[model samples]
Target chain A: MYKFLTTFLPKPLANIAMALWYFLLIIMNLYCGIAFAQGTFQYVGW
Target chain B: MRLLIEAILFAIPMILLAWTLPKKYVLLSQIIITALFIAYQSPLSFAILGTITFGNYYLLHKAVLRKSIKFVISLGILVLLIVSAKILFTIHDHWIIPLGMSYYIFRNIHYTIESYNGRIQNESLLFYLAYNFFLPVLIIGPINRYPEFIRDWQRRRVNSEYFSLGFQRILYGFSKIMIIGSYILSLKLSAIISNIDESKHWLKVYLETITVVLNAYFQFAGYSDIAIGISLLLGFRVMENFNFPFLASNMQEFWSKYHMSLTSFCRDYIYTPLASYFRRPMLGVFITMIIIALWHEITLPFLIWGSLQAFGIYLAFIFKDTPTSLVSKNLGRVFVFNYFCLSCVIIDYELAEALDIYKTLFFIN
Candidate 1:
């Protein structure tokens, strides 16, 4: 998957896509973190 | 949040050390860092874990050198007693199991068995300690083998690709845990179930069960991703723990994929020998399932859960040779997936609650 993204797409476009994906993950994590802080999210332990 | 924070904090220094440490000092640095991390988390856990690890190493070393079956048996019994005590204590609320005790004990057992089989080579105590205390996998593990770890260490080097891949993997883990698991399956699904009309009891129960199972999958697989990613960054490629188990078309395939490391370990250490001894493959499957179930917790519900799983596997085995087409294969996948989700209800709830769920599902009440 990494190779396909980096190789098939143009370098600039690939970089943009990667950035967008990372941005999505960061936003989700931040939202979840806030939910956790509010004690609305359940944390499962191993 | 605290665990995630501590893992990140631990990873940064470990990554730096992996990249910059002198060759001779790398092992020492790893040992010290891991020791400090464990001690910081809980001094009692550190002490107990330290004693078990060192004691196991010493006994294993002697058993290997002397090739003494008596020593090996004694060591095995001792380890078993410790694990049993921990489980019994936890069940009775008498004491807390030391951090990562389950994972490390299994590692020690693996080492002991392999050493007795002459599969293990002579290694220094420090190297053995490093393998046991390796922080990336200490808590939740892929149950990495000693030989693979030693090989990774021997050939380790700084690699940019590994670093990039590791970070990407960690990002994937966090996303799965936060967005998909905690948010969608857990919170949203629970809210949906609670808001359902009480008359739609079956729908609510089914959804709740699915939510619990899927939530467990994501949470576990997410943590595994984080552990694997961290190991990658540290230049050790640990074994993969999961492999898209829901896509399995049969119970055998599901077991092989879900919790790949643990299942494989049980297959190797438990099932094969039991099967050979009893000359009954079905008995092996049953015993292995029970062990896997009880490994999570020693409760009556888990025992029943394990029995149900074994029964499911037996049914699958009986139907193994049946002809299959595209539709049948898809049907098989659905059956396998639902079987797992439903069986999981047993382990997730008390016997009475689970019975209530089943009664509701079948309209028994």
Candidate 2:
């Protein structure tokens, strides 16, 4: 049943799932860049 | 009374940072926060906090038995508290409602649902209390589930690696919140958000909106970072919160990347149950979103945000299930997904403001 559902679901979902993995990879880089940004922060005031 | 004093005195130490003084003395800081008042400075706030804590304790204690009826009862109760707080706060303007009630509600829900799902067979009251009120993840969360939380606890008998790793995560998180999140707030760009007068230009609004999104990421993700970091300092191994969610290519993938613990929690408990609502494989995926939005405590803006996300997920479900490769590209998917998410954040601002901005974004204006 599970296998049949996957087969019938079409290729777009697979493409999306694959795209999502790639997207996560890109986000990892963006996150690393952002994490290192703003060398200092002021916790209290504006 | 306590919340007032803390919010007041909190300013001084926040500037000086009580956290910096002695990492080992966190227990003392908490005791000081608690020793301030019988009720939260405001009565309404007190009720919300008290009620949610009641929900957390109530659900957790009930989870220990592993009985089917009690298990069901616990989840139902936790959900009820979440909805009640959100409704009361939103429609009635009940401010200072609860400090970390929503997050703890998730914690409680996690324990209950995990017990019901057969993921958690063993638990003790002390461990459960610590997990729920760990104080680090308490305010903002990485949203720990009980089974995984229990496993981590058992495995953490006495490992310095845990401490070392935990501190690294904490310091990094604290720095993120303190440095990165704060830096954005301090910029003049954020000032435009508050002064949303008719004088505000379209370009300025656009700039402010971008700032708001960045600020949201930094502030919330920073909170998670702090939670992870502090939990580490205290010898608890809370899970990581953000996984570079912003770079997600599609809405579905973004959901998986962001607030991952909550996303999975809702997926397992709400989405799964709702999926069972009808036999159709393509389901009322948005139903899960309503639960997710309500998790923020049922405000109108939050409801809209949740609904918008549900819309995104529903669309993703349709697209993914259909096998449309054209819509799923690395750069193209990221633009669509984040644009969709940014649209939701716009709606989260205010209904009138959201409608106006939507008109402009869609070029209806």
Candidate 3:
């Protein structure tokens, strides 16, 4: 399994060994979006 | 208003699917999509959608596994569809563009093509529809290869983490669409560009060209983000269509960053073969670019847009074997990127006035 993980990923991305790494940063930022939005629709953009 | 309502309806089903059964849900999801398109009062397009779905489905089966004939006949049929439905928009001049036609059409034929190439395992009808008509990425797509997309679909088993991850993607998408995209859209870059006087501040043309490219990316990315976000809320994962594309250092990289799925589709289906046939890399790039332009619309501006990129990419390919590697690649990237943006600026002009606007670029008078 370790060998498989090393081979499957690009060297730069190998640190994110879990299968879900592609989405980790995105998930963190989503909470940031809600915090930024604070329920305001007018100037809050989208 | 209508866009907002449609957006809501779009997100609702995918969320439910994630909650219920993520992997198998595309089966249900596709059925809903076909039904929704019909309800959208574009029932006429049902023929177009249904025909493409079944046509490729049957043709690929016969051509590949059955070995009824080589791939030529199937390829020919797809080309004919492209010409009539996509190109002519109907010889009648009164036909409507099919709903979600381009994405689905491309998906259908592409699936068949890959299957024929032995790149994919046999997919069930359920997976097929989900791939073709998956609502999250339907209108705009980060088009998934059958193998990659299906793997993701089948493997998905929703849990709290999945919900949170999906929500995150959706929220991020909404931020791009509702906020930044709105501002870029409101700028109406083309309108501003058109009004600028040729005599003074003439650099406006270049500025406008740059602006048009930015606006287009934002608008497209914004919509894609919304799609991504909504699907997330529903606990489904849709691949992203855009990365930080403008940051792309070269035409090749730009494509990888921007509208990635479409670019990959074109590359797989069009570019590589053309390159191989010509035995001169430039020819393939040029021809492939034209196909990309034609996909945008059968118009001169779009053709020019596609042509310029092809020409630039061809130049880069020439530089591939050159000694001044880094500099040549960088120069080629800027040239293609600028040309791509400028061509879009011309495309932004009114169809009737496009020629005149183009003339203005040269004369500046």
Better of 1 and 2 by TM-score: 1
TM-score of chain B of each: 0.95, 0.75, 0.82
Each model's backbone clash number:
0, 8, 8
Kindly give the stretch of ten consecutive residues in candidate 1 chain B with the minimal lDDT sum. Answer: B62-71
lDDT for each residue of candidate 2 in A1-46, tens digit (9 for 90 to 100): 2245458666777667655644554454355446445433233221
TM-score of chain B of 3: 0.82
- Please rank every candidate by DockQ, starting with the best: 1, 3, 2
Q: Pick the candidate with the highest DockQ.
A: 1
Expressed as tens digits, the lDDT of each residue in B1-365 for candidate 2 is 12222443433442233336454343345434432332444455445555555565565555465477776777778777777767787778846556667787777777766665777677654555445545455555777866666566555444566656655554555445444555445443466466766565655556656666766676677667656655555456677767888766667888888888888877777677767878543354677777777666566677777777767766666667554455556664667545754666545477787778766655685
DockQ of each: 0.57, 0.07, 0.07
For DockQ, candidate 1 versus 3, the one ahead is 1
The interface RMSD values of the models, given in order, are 2.0, 8.7, 6.5
Error (Å) of candidate 3 at residue B315 is 3.3
Top candidate by lDDT? 1
Off by over 4 Å in 3: A1-46, B1-4, B21-26, B62-65, B68-73, B90-94, B159-162, B184-199, B203-205, B231-237, B318-337, B351-363
lDDT of 3 by residue, B1-365 (tens): 24534756755764665466644445686567545754574777766676776677666664344543535666677677766776667345587676666676677667767876787785577667666766666665656567866666556555676665655555555545544444333334445667788775446756765765665676577677666666555445666688777655566667677787788788888888877888876777778778878886776777877887776665556555666567765665676667667667657877656565566566745
Report the Cα lDDT for candidate 2: 0.60
TM-score for each model: 0.93, 0.69, 0.75
- Predicted candidate 1 versus true structure: per-residue lDDT over B1-365, tens digit per residue: 47667967986897788779898888788888888888998898899778877777666665455667645664566568555865786578867677787788788888878877888885689889889889889888889999999999888988887888888889888878888888888788788899999888799899999999998899889888988999999899999999999998989889999999899989999999999999999999999999888887777888889999899889889998999899988998999999999998888887889899989877896
TM-score of chain A for the candidates in order shown: 0.82, 0.45, 0.38
Candidate 3 chain B weakest lDDT stretch, 10 residues: B178-187
